[model samples]
Target: MSVRRTVTVSITPEQDALLCAFLASGRYRSISEVMRSALRLLERDEAATLTAMRRPVAHDEASRG
Candidate 1:
């Protein structure tokens, strides 16, 4: 089991409309579900970005060895 916390966030009208669209599509059950999916994507993207940033350094060191 995990603990859950509620946080209030402000979104622009455009963002609100997008969220409503997702809800209408029935792909997500709630705003929380949509937010969780978005967060997961963000985390994956950040990790990929970090790996990309380190790739050039790794290649340079390999060539010098």
Candidate 2:
């Protein structure tokens, strides 16, 4: 089992409407599910960004001859 943490977030009215719309579509069971999925995607993107930043540039590698 995974541990869960409670967090407080503030969203704009538009964001709240969007979430409500998503819920109405029956795609997500709750706002928490939507947020969790979004956070997971964000984490994936951030990790990818960090990995890209740490990678050696092709031009720099060629200049080391």
Count of backbone clashes, every candidate in sequence: 0, 0
Residue 17 lDDT, candidate 2, scale 0-100? 99
TM-score of 2: 0.80
lDDT of 1 by residue, 1-65 (tens): 68999999999999999999999999999999999999999999999999988777876789999
Q: Name model 2 segments beyond 4 Å from true.
A: 60-65
lDDT against the true structure, each candidate: 0.95, 0.95
lDDT of model 1 at position 62? 90
| Candidate 2 lDDT, 1-65, residue by residue in tens | 79988899999999999999989999999999999889899999999999999998999989997
Reference-based lDDT, residue 43, model 1:
100
- Pairs of residues at least 3 apart in sequence or in different chains that clash in candidate 2: none
